[model samples]
Target: MKKISLYHTEIENKDGISGHVRSLTDDAFNQLTSSPLKSVPGTNPEQLLGAALATCLNATLEAEEKRRNLPHQAIVRVAVDMGRDYQGFQFWLRVQVKLPQVDQQEAQEILAICEQRCPVAKLLAKSQNVKIELVNEFGFKEEFK
Candidate 1:
């Protein structure tokens, strides 16, 4: 198999669970990161991962909507739960998608395609803890204990 690079970027985090994370490819991409266990004034890995999944999946959904000549009204929401497992700390992700412009069956089809196409979703597909759902409304439950 041949591999071709469509895009590449590097991100660096120098201070572990606290401090700053910045992208080497883009100077404007920088953010303060902190531990989720702390009440610090910064974003944590859980939020960041959720944001990435939501953004990437929504963008892929938007592309599919555009191809179908429908209004771009798809919404993607990701909820990440971090907890202790037998091995130590583990994370579970639940992604919900809403496509208001289409019927439930069509929405499910679109979501299926998006799941296969979305980069972030594909990356997380290997994990049994990751879930992708097609919903008419958003109602995320609390999973952390």
Candidate 2:
């Protein structure tokens, strides 16, 4: 088997990590995020979770669209709600994925893929490594990528 690597690029300005995202295929991408730390300008972890789910759903949808030759673009809109818990802030995401000409059974199947394959959804569900790192208004912070 051949090892494949996909490349994507982003730049940070006054507003955190925001730039173009690309892959082996697809020309669908826009401004990535805004630092929620107010000082940092990029989105926080919770927003990242939502973005992760959306990314995975979009990726999966792209593959399916190509396979089925569907007309019009299939969109996967994901919304993540945040709240406090015993551990920390917990995110409740509602993935209202919309696609054309898909039945309930098919919708369920796509959702299953998003739920299982979306890295953030799986990570949140698995509860393997859940932690929060606090930083100052504009202080340096680091973690495992």
Candidate 3:
């Protein structure tokens, strides 16, 4: 498939402790800094990564749901853990997706498709460990890795 879109962002960092990020969209400006425990108030790369993955995966799932005529409300929470690994720095993700309009089997199916379709999920899962939990209205839950 040919690429249809390209997104750009720039991060200005000096001391590795504080920085600013700018993307093509004017509303995408963000103040970047180390974790609160390590520095002053601001956002860190891990937080931004988690946020981006959550939003991107949610959008992908929304599109799939629309295409499949499966209307549902959902909340996706993504947690990113950053630490040192044998190869150097590494990160992992814990994602929980709550769906109000599907059963466990259906939710799992939808999430499986989303995992294959979401670009962020694809990229991250290639190099980072990603764990996803899907929950439905009946309280049924399933996990994927």
Best by TM-score: 1
- Give me the displacement of residue 105 in model 2, in angstroms: 3.3
Enumerate residue pairs that collide in model 3: none
Instruction: Give candidate 2 misplaced runs (Cα > 4 Å).
Output: 1-41, 113-145
The positional error of residue 27 in candidate 1, measured at the CA in angstroms, is: 0.5
Q: lDDT scores for all predictions?
A: 0.93, 0.54, 0.75
**Which prediction has the highest lDDT against the true structure?**
1
lDDT of 3: 0.75
| Residue pairs in collision within model 1 | none
TM-score-based ranking, best first? 1, 3, 2
Distance (Å) between predicted and true CA of 25, model 1?
2.0
TM-score of every candidate: 0.95, 0.51, 0.76
* Candidate 2 local lDDT, 75-96, one digit each (tens): 6655555566899866555555
Displacement of the residue 2 alpha carbon in candidate 3, Å: 3.6
- Models ranked on lDDT: 1, 3, 2
Model 1: lowest-lDDT 10 consecutive positions? 136-145
